[model samples]
Target: MTEPLHSGEVDRAEYDVERGKIREFARATFTTDPVHTDRNAAQAAGFTEVPATLTHTVVAGHQREQRKFVEMLGLALERVVVGSVKWTYLRPLSAGDHVVGTRRIVDDVQREGKRGGSMRVVTLETEYVDADGDPVVRLEEVLIERGEQR
Candidate 1:
């Protein structure tokens, strides 16, 4: 890598949750929770509509944003591996809730390895805020690049 990426907003996106996606996620994850699939059940649980589980937010963010900072840093996706994904959720997001998110470069480091090779560890943090501008969740992830860099 030319230089270690600095902390800053690297990408952004907006997402609108749909009930079907939550239902599919609930089923795929074997949640078996009525609140995830049943709109009425979710509303009864205090959400205006079916809410996405904590896991769904990360999935939805990736799908909807369709981006990453490694790519922006001119790194290859095939060489990147997820080291960790830490989440901090402030409030549950409901279906029909429009959320805006920013993908930020929290840190990046390059280290020398054996056999005269080097690797880069890129840290990213994404924060999602609802249309109400309330913070929803913060996803802190570390992506490590392997193999040789061009």
Candidate 2:
């Protein structure tokens, strides 16, 4: 059985946006935009530094934090199903930026399954802020934990 769910922060971590990492990610993701890898090019393009691709947050170690979050909640990883994922970009995050991500449990609900078991839906939100505490990005993930068979 899973522990009771609560709506609050679960984890927080600081992520350093390094230039080499941004370049590597840009190459790996086939981001042809020079602004993502070349500082001079980025500067010419009116950016202060190399900017990361929009989906670069996927590699920011949030998955490990989420796994720990599930474990802390006493939920079995095998029984959990991803419902949906959403990302909202508030501002651009560039190399040389130190961003802090705070993860929270925003919603939890119990629902009756069509079959015969109960289901638990949990929504987790992670907010990223720059060094000056300005919002940079927001990520929300919905997970559903299935109950045991009848």
Candidate 3:
């Protein structure tokens, strides 16, 4: 049997934003807001560069880190379901910005179900800071699934 995942902080991961990545995310999320996709539109909008929404930053940074965390735990990705996600933005993230992500396991609990099953809910909180060390966003994600199924 595989060991249970240890609850702790994961190593921080950093990514330098690429123009292509920003454009792709914006397009994929259906964010047609010119300030997010077009450089000229962004400048016209009073931004020196395209600005990404909080959701964009969260998705790009958190998703990769979460997958790595699952791998570190030797857990199957398909066995887990995202129960909830919340993001709080402290500052705007521009297209050319670089971000560092720190993820920590905030809570873990196991419960027995009336149907003779057991489940675990794990809560993880991640903070994203810009190159200047200013916090840009904070995200909380909850994953839940049957304990033994994974």
TM-score of each: 0.81, 0.84, 0.79
| Candidate 1 TM-score versus the reference | 0.81
Instruction: Encode model 1's per-residue lDDT on 5-99: one tens digit a residue.
Output: 57677887777877888888888899987999998888787878888877876655555434444556766778888899998989887788888
Candidate order by lDDT, decreasing, is 2, 1, 3
lDDT of 2 by residue, 36-68 (tens): 877899999999888888877776674356677
**Displacement of the residue 55 alpha carbon in candidate 2, Å:** 2.1
The segments of candidate 2 whose C-alpha lies over 4 angstroms from its true place after superposition are 1-4, 62-67, 114-116
Q: What's the lDDT for candidate 1?
A: 0.79
Clashing pairs in 2: none
The C-alpha lDDT values of all candidates are: 0.79, 0.83, 0.76
Regions of model 3 farther than 4 Å from truth: 1-5, 58-68, 74-76, 114-116, 148-150
Candidate 2, TM-score vs. the true structure?
0.84
Q: Looking at model 3, how many pairs of residues clash? A: 0
